[model samples]
Target: MLFPASGHTKAHVLHYYAQIAPVMLPHVAGRPASFVRAPEGPEGESWIAKNPPPGVPDWVPLVPVEHRDGVTEQVVVDSTAALAAMVNLGAYEVHVPQWTAAGGRDAHDRLVLDLDPGPGADLVVCCRVAERLRQLLDEDGLMACPVVSGSKGLHLYAPVEAVSGRGASAYAKGLAERMTVEHPRLVVASMAKLERRGRVLIDWSQNASAKTTAAPYTVRLREGSPGVAAPVTWDEVAACRAPSDLAFTPEAVVERAAERGDLLAGLLGEGVRGRVP
Candidate 1:
């Protein structure tokens, strides 16, 4: 279905996952995945499949996660077979929480900061805001890695040594609020679009329990062509002129992983402490 736009076939997408599964699984395994499938094609309508749909093979693992109202079964992409199956099922994108299944819903393994451009702003502005966040994180004795969202912005992730969902949420929220106060010209923490005008929003809500960020190396279905949520270095972020500059297809992503290894692999281990008082 995507052959016309991206020149990629279903087989190509599956092969891409098959090749990158080794590196990708290390980051996604044991996490509750919210599969974003585009069965109709990149340009066609798509839906987010939270629970394992009917007819899923028994080999596919499922994790029961509690929500505000009740508990639901979420799929975990732990194996190469599972990843390829999802791709064959038209799951173009995979979004997972910062925690693992062993940690369940409480223990979070990482902290993420999503830098989104406001209404009047673009990705260039987003890059500037990300740089400021990196500097602040550096002062805190933490290391933050940048990942191109492959759409409109960048996401910064830092490994949290020993932190829970609550701790991560509070720390990220505080930092975002602080950025808005310290850098009023370029940053805003408000979720309101109006408040985001001419500024880049440091979205802090993704740190909460059960929240999911787009898994690295997954392809995003957007206008024109699909874009891969590829990991990038700080230098690439600063040098980028537009969002498309960081865009990658399935083929490009696999090649990138082969060359650079997993840029996000370091985030899987113990990192700087939250140190929130």
Candidate 2:
């Protein structure tokens, strides 16, 4: 099995991406994605040469790299318009972030919901939670996707325009509290570690770029192979019963998605309500 990536060398970091991204790029069809090399990242061309990813083209600009409490993140982002630029650059390379932080981007005000089934959560039950989350967002017309944590949980993502006048923090906090209030066992927003032990911790902290969450497609050090970390539709998400049980690769996710179709699409229309405030 693949060992957690050694953070020792920029080359080692780039090597894995060079080897892995080709298999993963197809799933990220609508986002602007790029890689950043540590230490050297903020300097200049040194970062690019030290960790030159396999397929990224020539046009992508060198971004400032970020290192967080637990992981080292290359300051790359994926977005609808950015994805187009990445293709224009050269290689649509992938990355495995050791520490991730978010802040400078316009991603603020966007909502993120972490659907965690506490320790020893039954896969069947967790899948049900995933299904329910999908429904809730769908009913509200919010954009959301499902992701499997390297450990025993899953996460749901919802995007709101932070620019809509509501700060990302307020919008995310209110929604998290509301979910816990409405579905006590399904979502928990408290910081008490004890409460999170056996329940799915609904985390909405990613509203700030400074807050870090695991990105899809990258393997968690202790976790095994990182599977297709792309966005899935509500139908696909609703049907999932513990996606962790299955092996993931960008190719596999794409193949599966084609056969099954995405479930979250119709939910992102205008007029999503209940602002953070």
Candidate 3:
């Protein structure tokens, strides 16, 4: 099932993902080409490629792609060149019947935590880090969202401007860094892990305008499926199961969004034109 039908290597399927690269473009519309491909390896195959992959062994799906009668829709987007190409091709990120969002109207500042539990990191520790972050935000009356990384970790994000008048970026970086510094045992925001010893990165750097974190529902080509992320409320996170103990599936995620409506819905409709202001 992992093998591609007919005659395609997993590498070929990965290349196909790169060739498409239109899904991520629209979401990052206002930003410049800070987007980079996910990176290729020695054999030159990757769904996205911005850097040299560190022997990320040629990965094939652990599970077979389920048959849905039709191709499970997909979108690819990376790099400014890719964004331009997608627009030229008339690709757009829109509300599909399967995926829909509502409510983010009030122009609140957004700070998403791209929680990467690390390649070999412990999941229990990841959940603990998220818990601490939530406490810090709630004491300050901030609105945050928790999401599954779709790979190895969990992300915890809090809306800054909603509570704090300004200092949105500063606050996000400050909290992310503090999580690493304050709890040396649980977290790390350092880009270089060896330098950080052993710790999970809080990853608030994605808050910068020039940067863009993977949007919700976006796929990480490495994973067999779309690897869509799961968004959870602070209350849910408080109950605290464990990130490693959980794998938020695509069906569960879309289902959850449908039940609660999307927290980012209004933010998506904030009317920020793609053009630079």
Highest-scoring model, lDDT: 1
State every prediction's TM-score relative to the real structure. 0.93, 0.57, 0.55
Candidate-wise lDDT, in order: 0.82, 0.47, 0.46
The 10-residue segment of model 1 with minimum total lDDT is 268-277
lDDT of 2 by residue, 118-146 (tens): 66555445557667666676666665566
- Choose the strongest candidate by TM-score: 1
Residue runs of model 1 more than 4 Å from their true location after superposition: 271-277
- Give the residue spans of candidate 3 off by over 4 A: 1-44, 47-108, 162-167, 235-245, 263-277
- Report the CA-based lDDT of candidate 1 relative to the real structure: 0.82
Query: How high is the lDDT of residue 52 in model 2?
Result: 36
**RMSD to native, candidate 1:** 1.8
Error of 3 at 122 (Å): 3.4
**RMSD value for candidate 3:** 12.6
lDDT of 1 by residue, 70-127 (tens): 9888889999999887777788789999888898667777889988888888888888
Error of 2 at 36 (Å): 11
Worst 10 residues of 3 by lDDT: 92-101
Better of 1 and 2 by lDDT: 1
Better of 2 and 3 by lDDT: 2
Which parts of model 2 have CA positions greater than 4 angstroms off?
1-60, 64-74, 77-109, 164-166, 223-230, 241-251, 257-277
